[model samples]
Each structure stands twice: as C-alpha cells, then as structure tokens.
Target chain A: MVALATQTISSMSNTDIEIVVDDPTAPEENSPAVASTRVVDIVVSLLLLALAVTLGWDNWRTGASWDSTGPQPGYFPFYLSVILGGASLYGLGAAFVSRREATETFVTRAQLRRVLAVFVPTLLFCLATQYLGLYVASFLLIAGFMRLVGKIALWKSVLTAFVFTAVMFVTFDIVFDVIMPKGPLEAALGR
Target chain B: MEAFGLLLHGFAVLLTGKTLLLMMVGLVLGIFVGVLPGLGGPNGVAILLPLTFTMDPTSAIVMLSCIYWGALFGGAITSILFNIPGEAWSVATTFDGYPMAQQGRAAEALTAAFTSSFIGSLVAVLLITFLAPMISTFALKFGPPEFFAVYLLTFCSFVGLGREAKHKTVISMSLGLLLAGVGMDTVSGQLRMTFGSAELLRGINFLVAVIGLFGISEILLTMEERLALRGHAAGISLRVVLSVWKDLPKYWVTLLRSSVIGCWLGITPGGAIAASFMGYNLAKRFSKDQESFGKGRIEGVFAPETAAHASGTSALLPMLALGIPGSGTAAILLGGLMVWGLNPGPLLFVEHKDFVWGLIASMYLGNVVGLVLVLTTVPIFASILRVPFAAVAPMIVVSCAIGAYAIQNAMFDIWLMLGFGVVGYVFKKIGIPLAPFTLALVLGNRAEDAFRLSMIGSGGDMKVFWSNGLVGTITTLAILLLFWPVIDKALTSVTRMVRPAKA
Candidate 1:
C-alpha cells in the first residue's frame, strides 16, 4: 500500500500541472466510487449517538441515586456520554457543510490487514488463557507468533517460547509469591 | 559536610554486590536495546521494568537508573556508524558522525562521542547529587497552581519549540487529555468513559501506552519499509580511539555551550531533542569552517552528543525533586517509582533518602560503565542493523505485549496495547507529535487531581493561587510562554528594522 502511495506521489510530482491530476496507473488512487466524507461522518455520528443513549439510559436505571452530600455514581459519566454524543453530532454537521475536498479514508483495506494481524492473535490469546492458564497460553501464543510472524523454524520457536515463559513463571510465581490464575491445564497436571 | 556524609552513606548502599551486579546487567541491557534502531531509552526501560518488580525500591531504582544511562550512551554508537540514529537526540550526530565514519574515521568519531557523553552526563549527575536537595526544598513552595502552570509550560514549549505545526501538537495533546479522562473520577468514584467495560475502569496504564506507541508502532513502520542491509566490516582500534583526545581541546568551547543549553532545556521540560538541535545549530553558526560542518567536522558531532546526554541526564532532576518528568524517559522512570510504591515529590528526599541518594550515586557509576561498555562493543552492536526486520519485528511486538500484560497481569491491557498501537500509527501518518501527547497523558490526571485538591483546600477561592508568590511567578511564566512566538517574531522584526537603519 505504501509502495502504491509512493508511486502515485512521485508520478504527481513529475506532472507539469499545478493541480493534482488522476494517475492512470494507480486504479485505487484514481477511483471515483469512493464513499463520500459526509456519508461516513453521518454514519459514525449516528452510531456514537446510539451508544451514548444506551449507556446513559443503562446508567440511569442501574446506577446509584444522588445524595445531598455529593454526586451520584452515574453523574460524571452520564454527562460525558452526553458531551460525546453532542460533539459527534457537531462533527456530522461540519462534514455536511464543509466545501473542502474529501480527504483520504483512514481505514483502507491494507490498513485493516495490518490491524487484524495483531488483533486476532491477541483475542485468541485472551480466550486461551482462561482454559490453559496464563503461562501455558502465553507460551503457545509466543511460539505460534515466532513461527508464524517471525518465520522462525519450529524447534527454535518452541525453545525460545519455553525459555521466555519459564523465566517469567520463576520470577513472578516463585520469587514474588504472586498467585497466578490456575486453569484446567494446571488442574489436570495436579501441581 | 552533611551532604558529603549522606552521599557516602548512599555509596555504601550502592556499592553492595547485589546492587552493583544489577546495575551492570541493566547497563548492558540498556546499551543493547538503545543501539537497536527504533528501540530507544523509554522502550528499553519499560521492557525491563517488570523484572525489578520484586526487588526493593532502592535496588530497583539503581537498576533502572543505570539502564537510563546505558541507553543514552548506546544511542551515539549507531549515530556515528550506520547513519541511522537510535534516538531522536542522536539525529544531529548523523550529520558529521556518519560522514566521518564514511571517511574511515569511525573509531575517532565514536571515541569523541563516548567521551563527550561521559563528560556531559557526569556534569549533570554531579549537579543532581548536590543540587537536588536544594531544588526539592524550593519546590515545597509550589501548590497546585504552580504545578498546573508548569504543566502548561511543558505543553506550550513542545508546541512552540517543536518543528512540527502547532495545530497538530495541540490536537495530539487534546487527544491525550481525552484519553486521560477515562476510568473512574477520583472525587466521585464515577466512571467517565468506560462505556460499561470493566477493564476501562482502571484507566490505560502509561507503560502500555508508551510501549505500544514507541515500540510496537516502530516495528510496524520498520516492516513497511525495505531497509538497506549494511555490512559491518570495520573494526575500531584502541589507538584510533585514543587519538580523539587530541581534538578535544579544540571543541571544549562548543562542549561547554552545549552543556549549558542542555541543562537549562532539561530543567524546563524542553527535552534532549530541543537541546541537541539548538546545540547543533549554534555550533555550526559559530564554527570557523561552517562549510565543513555537514560534511565531516569533528565539532559538529561533539556538540549534539554532549548536549543530548547532558539534557537526557538532567531531566531526572525535576522528576526526582518535584514529581515532574521533563522527558519521555523520565516519565517512564516516574511511573517506575510509583510502581515501587514510592511517591516522587519534595518529601521523597526526606522519607526515602537512601533510595534517592542511592539512585543518584548509581547514575555516576552507571555513566562510567556505559561509556566503557558502549565504546568497546560498538562494532558488535552495529552488526544488529544487518538482522532481518521480519525476525526482529515480531519479537518487539511480543515483548511490548508481555510488558503491558505484566503491569497488572490483566489480559485486558493487551487489547489496550493494540488500541494504542493503532493510535500511534495514525498519529505518525497524520504528522502529529506523539511526544507531547505522551507527556500530557503522563501528567494530565496528576495535574487535574492537584488542581481539584488545591481548590477544595482554598474554599473554592481562585484568588488563593494568585496570592501565593511562588504560584504567581510560575503562572506568569506560563502566560509568557503562551505568547512567546508572537514576542519572538516582533522582537526579530524590530531588530531587523533597527539593524538596517543603523548600517
């Protein structure tokens, strides 16, 4: 994606015109079917508004009542929700009226791939921790990442992960005497 | 005599076998991480902080402070050899240091930078040891108003003094403040922006944010670029290193000037980058052979190296004495102090004298170790640039994730780490200054809490802040800082108008 952007920028630099002309070679950069900035702004604003209303309503029902001495549990949060909703609406209006050209979108397809590469594994690690315990889950996570992302050999990845997790276990569990969460794997091991 | 006695006692603690061993380990680790491109001082310290969690406060600080020194020394190695600065402060060094290296003067440039860094850090450490107590005593005069003013000054200086556009810096700072407003409100115990998520109740940890922004984001950026792999073929000799001393006297004036600029900027929260840039420009302007500066002038390399180390070291003074961190690394150190259950204000010296003094003593010892270690291992560390990005990038990500999780042993923080990683990537893409944002995030909640407490103590009378002389002085300085750009522009125009007429 960066290569494409760089190519487009370099080609544009070589042009004689003062204004930016569409480069024929870069299809994505020159595409005319892209979503309008106003449409995105409105959709994001509405989603935020729904979130604010839901949270504010839930707090009003479940949160602590106000006392004369000070604020209630939901006092500060409820107000913040309102402000967030209001600001989002303001953004929506600004996007609607602004005559400036639509800027580039933040989350392109390439950017999404980058985000998912880290995010998916992290999600799996969190779920795996409950069943395998912190140490085991972290070991597997590290080994898998080393093999998959780092492209290391199987034995090397396994060895590195084992050493890393073992050192952490020794330091935190034995030395610090902090209790780690024991899951089914530890229970089955009976130690 | 009393200060000398206390320092001796501090040394007594620092010289113990356990403390010395940990300090040495930290120094080596710091140098290793600092020499690696994109993994500078803050990331190095954050990655290693969890290791010291079980140790006593004094020993932990000794290790961490040594790590800080080692990282400062390590940054110069890559700057001189590879033309890739390990830290932003080392950017100036690449102007001349890399040129010298290309000309087969790599050993001399490395030696000059190492010795100058040693001298600069030594001066700053000496100042901290003697002057910290006095600074702490004076800092007792500050209330919330003064602290608020200082925080404002810190933000403004980054905006005003930075090379980036002011609007972008302000946006980053506001984003940080918004992030800081998450979690429960201190006064009311009311959640602010948690959105009913239990993890958000505790707020985002500063370490997690820093690791994600500086560490993980850097790795991702490295992955995007097709970096040229440079081979390490040259070896530095002791004789060539020793020859740097011959040119030392010629650059002593630049060294002194850079050191002063470093200390002043370091104290005021302007940080190492500002000090180094200013020092580099000043040295170039004053040099007899200005044309040779960017090509391969020894003085060009010496000035920034001295100022960067000096400023980086002196930033600790405000952090230790006043609970005010003057740079990103110092902010991480402040977070470390908090994790060790030690508050960093005026009373830290009184209540935790051994820890404070021991840390100060370790700074001196660590500088010596850092200089010797980095000078000896420059060739080996420069080889790190030859390693494939794919192999190292994932390791960086894993280290940062683990570091974040270790902070609270919570899986939720790992997610926050990823979120911050995305924020960092966006900030970089949009040309926003991440340093100011990180600085504000570190100081925001503390500033808010102080402000609230002060107002409550003063019976909600805002006049109380202005009535206090010290607070008033700081507040005035902050106001002046806000208008500094306008003032500077007007002054420059007047000087230009007057000079032409006089001529």
Candidate 2:
C-alpha cells in the first residue's frame, strides 16, 4: 500500500491521467478524542475564547482606558486578548471547514494507552510529593515504575530506587545544600 | 597589543588552584544538569548562584559561568543520544543528531557538535575581548522603541518565515502571551488573569513550562514503543573523534557564518534559542546538501550547537557592557554580580578590570575544559541509552519532578508542569511547532513591556518605533519580514516574467 502510494505520487506529474484511489484500509482501532486534530483545535479555540472573555472583562474592570497616567494596566493586555479570541475563533472555523484533515487522527489508541501508562504514574507521583516529600515520594514512584512498567524483580527495583533517591539526597540535600521539601521520614532523620 | 597583555594577566588570574578546581566542578555540575531533562543552563546557574554567595565573587562567577558552558555543551549529548533536548536551544540539534545516532555515527556526530560549539564560543569570546567596549558604547543609544522593534522582528520572523502551520503558530504565540500576562500587571499594579488563585499570583515560570513541555512530553512519546533506549553503537574511539576533527574544517564557512549569527543575536536580546534557529535555517537555506539536513547531516548538528554555544556565551557581553541581560541565564548572573557589589554596566570594565578579564579568560579556558570533559563523558552518557526505556522513563519523570519542585519548592509548579507536558504532547500530536511557543513565552512579556513603555514615552504615538533611524530601520525590516511571503511571491513572479521575456 505504501509503495503504491509512493508510485502514484511519483507519477503525479503526468497530468493527463486522473487517478482515483482510496487509501488501503486497516482494521479500525478505537480512537480517543485527542487523536482527532479537529476535535483538539475546537477545544483549544473555545478555551482560548473563554480566556479572552475573562481577560477582557478584567481589563475593563481595571479601566482599560488611557487615563492621564497613560494607558491603563489592562490596555495592552485587552488588545492581546482580542487578538487571541479572534485568532482562535478563526481556527475553530477552519477546523470545521478544512477538507484535507477530515479524518486525520492525531494518535492511535495504542499510542494513547502508552502515554497514559507513563502520564498517570507521573501525576500520581506529583500528588504523592505533597504527602511523602521529594525523597520518599521519588523512591516509591521510581520503584513503582521499575517494578510495574519495567517488570523487574522486587529486590532490583527497590535497590535501584533506593540508590537513585539516595544519590539525589546527597547531591541536592547534602552537597548543593538545596532545601527540598521533607516529609516525616526526613523530619525524623533530622535532616 | 594591550588586549594581548590584558589577556595574559587574565590567564594569570584564571589559572589559580581554587579557580581551576572550581571550573572543573562547574563543568561536572553542568554536565550533570545538562544531560538531564528539565534542568537547564539558566536553572542550573540559578540553583548554584546561592552557593557562590559566600565565596569571592570572581571565583564564584567563574564556577557559575563554567556550569553554563557545561550545560550548553551537555544539551547536545542527550539530544543526540536519547532524542531529548536538555536545553531549549538544543531543539535544533535533535533534527540531525538523533539520526546520526541511529546510523551509528554517534561518536562522529558528537565530536563535530562539541568542536563546532567550541569554535562558536571561542569566536564569540574573542569578539567580546576586542569589540565589547566599542559595541557597548554604540548600544547606549538604544531605547525601548529600538528594543520593541528588534523583538517584533524576532517574533514575526518565526511566524512569517518559518514553514509551519501559520495559524497554529499564531495560536501558540497568543497562548504564550496570555500565559505571560497572568499574575500581576506590573505596569498598572493591577492583578490580571490571576482568577484569585495564589499560585496564579506568582505567574507561570517559563522554565517550569519548559520542563513540562519538552521533558515530560518526551517521556510520553517514548512510551508509545515498548521503550528501550536505542543508539548507533559503532562506539567512540580516538580514531572516529579524530576523523570528525579532520572533516570539520571543510565546513568552516558554516562554522564562521553561524558563529557570526550567534554573536550578533547574542549581543542583541535575540538570545541562544533564536540564534540556533536562525543558524539552522540559514545553514539549510545555503547548504548544497539541504535534503540531508534532518537526515543526519553532520553540518546540521554543527550549525545549531555552534550558534547556541556562541550566543549562550556572548550573551554575557551585553550584561557586562550594558546593564541589560541578553539571555535568561545572563540575567541571573547579573543579579549575582549586583549581590556581590559589582555593577554590570560600562563602569564594570574599569571598576573591576581583573574580574572582567578573568571571566573572559575563563570563557576561553572553560570551553576548552568543557569540550574536553564532555567529549570524554559522551561514551558514558550514551551508554545510559542502553538502559531499558521503562526504567529510564520513570527516572526521567522523577528527576523532572525534582527539578520542577526545586525551582520554587512548590508542588503546584509540578502540577502545572504536568499540564504543560500534556499540552505539549497534544500540540506535537497536532502539528504545532513548539519553538515559537517557547520563544514567545520567554520574550513576550519583555516585548509587551517595551511597547507599552515606548508608547507612554511618546504619549501614545505608535510612530515612536520609527522616530529614530536605528529604530525606524528595524521597524521597516520587521514589516518587510512579516510580509515576506507576499514580497517573496511578487519578486519571484517578476523574475519569472523577466526571464520569459528575455528568453
């Protein structure tokens, strides 16, 4: 299929013959909304428009006019907000109208699943940072990924995570003397 | 003759045991930071700036500056080895660098990159040593209008000349501008876009945003595969390194031209990332092997690395000669200077000739040291690529989280970074170019501030940008560049008509 498409593209310069061909279809995979560029564009545009309204309203409240003290704080920002809304609206319109990108998928289902596998863990790690502090949270996060995603041995993952977090403690906490967030473990250790 | 003498004295001061050891330490730290995603040159310097607070300002600054050098050199390592840009400027390096790694010429590519960077930084430092005093005298005449015009040119150049989805570029830039405007409206002392959230009060930090966008998004992208780091494994030897060296001089024109671009843009506020972009574009435009650029061309790696290093180093020239910082890292260094009782204006040249000359001398030695150090370490850094993707990806996330948290010690920033990462991933998935977004995020606030101040100075006259020849010419050129497609179309059509008539 790929080779045939390439051949057609190479022969495209010969304008005399008009070729009608459909792309070779594979079994359809379930698509996430993020996979569609059009869906993403519309969503992004609407959010930007909302941002414009919020900004424009705030600017008006703060007196978007030029007082005797020259332009108000919101004057320049207000105009920028307008441009943002305008550009985004145009984009939203274009997204719906564009023919070339009618069914183009941004990513396949498998790709999203892969991204989520890493992303969900990272997010949980961020939430865990508040409770466990940087060091403990990192240890768990690293160990989790190592054990779960990597399918490594429990001892190996624990050891690698321990060593990694231990090195970080020495570097940032001890050597650079940088003050990182500490949980109960650090507090008890008197670090 | 006098420069030669000053340079000798500078070297004399630079070779001290404490300074030499400190410079090595700086290079090591830089490599450590630069090879990691999220931790960047500016952030690395900012983090270490406090360590220098107790030491002698000169020695402290020498270490800090060497870290910057290390970080700049370090960026190319990861970009080539792991397809991650540790620094924003190294984005261009990944174009051909990863391909070279895939082709098993990783050693050759890395050698060219480091050597080209050395040449670029060496040329910039040399230019600074001789031309700084004179160039700064000319820079004193610049006003807000001129600054605004220059910024307009840069922003427009990205949006106009670069072949990307134009609307996407505009949308990305607008998002950046909007993000930058959040927090406080400093001009009027009014809060805009804060939505009354305390986190919004501090505004979004560009570095944190960068961490999320490049570092986190890259991890997500890597996951699509079963995830093992891959590299070209012909391996680094003295032979390959020497072969790259011998082949390097053939592209001296690219090296020289990119260095010049890096110097000019660095001295201006266009900065390292812009310089790299301009260098890569210009190299592509002029190269005989244009098609080979993103396909592992050695020259592609050289163009951006050299230009980025040159600009990253020479950005100091403006900070020393003028009070203005030409780059984010330079600004932090300037803040450090002020804390240590050294003003960074013209008076700095005379007030502390030893310090200035020593710093300059250290740039020379630092690049040499950095190149030698990083070249030796490339094998180790590259070998890390042999690790399974699952282990490495998680490690990248944790380090990125720590790096993000280390900036403000706020878990909120990490959350924000995660948001940016997802956005970055989606943006890439959709066809949005990130270079313009990052540039706008960095420079948008300054450009907007300059325009407003210029307007205030001119009593709301937009023509203030054209009031002086310097500003006017820049404004004209910016306008021309903004409409370059139309101008380009008209010119080409005219040529087409003339050729047919003549034929």
Candidate 3:
C-alpha cells in the first residue's frame, strides 16, 4: 500500500474545505491525486527565488552597470532579478500563512492521473518520433491513449488512429507539401 | 472625410474574393474552437496561428481577427445553451442566458446575445476607426523615455489593477523577463542564461510557450474537472430571431452602457472578463427591473454579451496603436504580429496602411458574418456540446504538439513545450497569475530595450522618464496604479472613520 499524504484546508474564499492529497492513482479505489496548494506555492516560490539568485549572480558577473555606449547588458535585468527575488521571498512567506494552507489542493489525484495519462504518452510519442517518425508515432500515440484512457477496444483504437493519421499525412504531406520526419518504413515506399 | 475615404479603401481591399473565403473559413473554425471545451480564445488563436505562417500579413490578420469575432459569438451559444462559458468573459452570460434557456427561451436568448454582440463589436470597430489614427499619431512622437514610461505603466497597471496578489504578479513578471533574457541579447550580442545549450540561444518562442501554457495546460486542468454539459435544445429559426430583435430595442440603454464599459476596459488592460462583470453589475444596479436579473432578464444577457464583444473587439486597438496587448487573446495576436515581421505601433499606420485598414474592414465584416453564422447554427453547436470531452482531449494534445513542433520543426522546442506545459500547470495550481507572465514574455525585451535606450540617452539618470509632461504624467499614473491597493485601503479606512454609521 502506498503511503498517502492527506490534508484539508479552506478554499480561496474560505467558503468550504477541500481535500489535498498525494496518493498513487489506483483504478480500484479512490486515488488521492491532488497536491496541496501550500506545498505547490512554497515549492514554486523557492524555485523562483533560486532562479532570481542565478540571474542576479549572472548579472553581477557580466558588468551590471552603465557604459559610454549605453547601459550594460545586465543593467536593467539586475533590478528585475532583485524584484523577482523579493517577490519570491514574499510568496514563500505568504504561502505558509495563507488561509487555506493545509487543505487547498493545487491538483487532485484523479486530475494528476489524467494529466499524466496524457503527458507520459506525449513524452513517449516524442521519443518514438525520432525512431519511427511522426505518422507512426502519432498513430501509436492516439491508439495507446484511446485504449488506455478512452477504454476503447484495441481494433477501434487502431482503426480510428489510422484514419486520423492518414488524413493528416495527406493534408500535410501531399497537399501542403510540408516535410515531416520519416523513418525506414516510410522510405520503404516510393518517395 | 479622410477617415471615411480610408475606410472605403479598406473595404475595397477587404472585399477581395480570397479574403472573403478566408473570413468564412476562419468563422467556421473559430466557432468550432469555441464550442469545444479545453480550448479557449487565446489558446485557439495561438494554436492556429502557425498554420497561417505562409499567408500575407493582411490576409493572415483578417482571418485571425474574424476567428476572434466568431469565438465571441460562439461563447454566448455555449453559455446560453449549455450553461458553460466558452471563455472567461462569457461566465456572466450564463447567469441570465442559461436561466433564459432553462425557461425555454433559449433561441430568444441566443438571438439577443448574438445581435447584441454584433452591435457591441460594431461600436468598437467604429471607435477604432476614428480613434486609432489619433492614438497612433500621438504615439509617433514618443521617444525612448515616453516609450519606457508607457511600458512601465502597462506592467504596473496589471500588477496594481489586477486582482492577483502583488507578490505573485511580481514573481510571474520577473520569471517571464528572465525567461526572455535566455536568448542572444541583440544589443550586446553576449549570450547569458543559455545553460550551455545551443537551442537556448534562440530563446523560447512566444507561440510555443503560449500553446503549452494555454493549450496543454488547459487539457491538464480540464482532465481534472472533466466538464459535462447537458445542452438545452432550442428551435433555430427566423421567427425566434425576429422575436429577439423585437425585444432588443427595449434594452438599448443596457447595450449602450455595456458597450461603453467594454470599450473603456478593453482599451485598458482590464480585459473582457472584468468588463463583462462590470457591465452586468452596473446594469443590475441601475436597471429599473433589477429584481428580474438572475431570473432570466433579457437585459442581463444583453449587458454581458455586449460588453464581452465590445471589449474583445476594442482590445485590439491598443495592440495596433501602442503595441500593448490588453488581453490574453490580444497578447497572442501581438505575438502573431511579431512573428509576421510586422512591427506594430504608431509606425504601422504609416508603413502598413493596407494591412491596418483591411483588418479594420474585416472587423466590421467579420462581426456581421459571425452574428449571422452563429444565429443560424445554434442547434448544430448546441448538439456539439454533448460530445464527450474524452474524445476531444487527445486531438487537442496532438494539435498542440504539432503546433509546437511546427514552429521551428525542432524536437527541442517540443521538449521545451512539454516543460512549459508542466510549468503552466504548476502555475495554475499555485494560483500564480499567467497573464502577467504572458505579457511580460512578449514585451519584456522591448521594455528593457526602451529602458536602456532612455538610460543611454540621459546618461543613466532615471529622471528621463519624468522629463516631459506626457511621460511624467504617465509615469506618475503608473506609480499610482501600482500602489492603488495601499492608497485605496488608506482612503477607505479614513472614510470609515469619518462616516462610521454609513454601513
């Protein structure tokens, strides 16, 4: 069993309590998928603060001042970085003190699963494109999604994905004449 | 007389056979996008923009702008028939428009909504026609200081006037600016923030960022919500339209008031969302029959729809004249403008008269075409709302990926897009505002350039922003807007003490 992290907090308007949870998505029972808003706010602000520091330090190294020709490259950006750092610190402070600190789920578990359901396949599709090319990659992606997420039959998924990919091939390849990435299979056919 | 002649020539340029077909196609496409869930005005436009890359700027802008008009019309259809707002501005439309539909007044509601949209957009177009030249003319005289003042004003106004927390706005804008600095600094030619990656040298493409932020993130957000719509069925006929037309004259005051509010908000960075709410509340507050508002008052529908369309149309004015986009969709349009190698601003009026005038002409024609098209296709679109979101999500994802890849035809951008999609999702989850980020991403370099130019011109003295009266007043106004919350709190507290028994 996956260890679940659960918290409850008031909403943006303090009207109702929302459950914030982090649990693996299980089709069998309810999956606590949403990350806590407080967690997200603090983490994002920290990342922003980190970015501000990096940018500011970089500016300092590259002459963040005025010259005879004009201001140096980092002149304006240095100030912007300082502002970013300040704001990020403020955001960090406010996130802890926020009204819905514990309960506000940035994204629910089911939502996370759904997003991952799309995101993971897209990543795979991008990887597949390098080897198999756009048409094959897209067909596999669409079919995989339909079967996995849509819960459609394999044949239906393949057929629908095939048709969609075919239309795209014609529209982009034959008519628009835009070049698409191709693989050995596409090269097996005549140009 | 000069403006009249230019408009006539604009119509002449716009009425070409190819442009007419393009407008119709764009309208159909826009309505389809609007009817679909998980894709919004800004998202749809940004996703569709790259496909028009090969077209002339005039034709491209005309088609894109028409799509914008059609989306405005389509938003009301979803609101009235499905009780779902297709765009943020359409949220207010559901208050009465949905109620009217529930009362079996769906056709009447939709007709009134579409017609009011037409009127509102027409009014905005007229305003643009008369006012754009003057505004552009004024802007033509702007130097680096004045330009920087305006840019600062825009940034500060968003931070001040926007409902988001000030810290979040600052963080979002700063992040955007930092992201913008990742490319080759055109002025110094010194590459910073490339992280030793060759792809990073080109900077993040606005089109790619927008597609990921709006399109991919929208999918993620919707997958969480899984919106289900049970649409109201209504007769799509001329009789219903005529009945609505007959009812429309009575709410003329509402229409006018909402249009004015919309035009005002749209020209500013307040956007259509704010305009619609303001229009609805003001109409409610001032109406003789305020009691009937949420209970299916036709004026309720009239107020929001008119304001939404008016603001949607007028938002383009600032983009055209000052090169500052006032809304998300307009920001996407500004990105499109930049991609097309057409520099938007005061010089556009002088340099690209045909493009400017033709776009204006299309606004008039597009609204008319959009109104008629949406009015007749109500039942078709209403039925489309029933299509399960599961079937649509994959296609959107695919489209977004294709758009991202197509921008540079590089795998790296796709990776960047995926990264930004996650970033977008995280931002949404954290309640960090995306508008300031988007605007800052698009305009960050320009603002920086103007600031540096001002500094150079004035030997690094920040006083250059306040050198001229125009720049000084604008800069002061920007400062006030940025601190408006604090000032407003202070004044209101004093007022509370002065009139303790008022509440």
Native contact recovery (fnat) for each candidate is 0.04, 0.46, 0.38
lDDT of 3: 0.82
lDDT of 3 by residue, B111-176 (tens): 888898998999999999999999999999999899889988999998999887889988888888
lDDT of each: 0.72, 0.77, 0.82
Residue by residue across B345-378, what tens digits does model 1's lDDT show?
8889889989888888888888887777776666
| Candidate 1: C-alpha lDDT | 0.72
What's the candidate order when arranged by decreasing TM-score? Answer: 3, 1, 2
TM-score of predicted chain A against the true chain A, for each candidate = 0.66, 0.79, 0.75
Candidate 1: regions farther than 4 A off = A1-155, A163-191, B487-503
* Candidates 1 onward: DockQ, in order: 0.09, 0.22, 0.22
Q: Please give, as one word, the docking class of candidate 2.
A: incorrect
* lDDT, model 1, position A27: 23
- Estimated TM-score for each candidate: 0.82, 0.78, 0.93
Query: What DockQ would candidate 3 receive versus the native complex?
Result: 0.22
TM-score of chain B of 3: 0.97
Q: Say what the RMSD of model 2 is.
A: 9.5
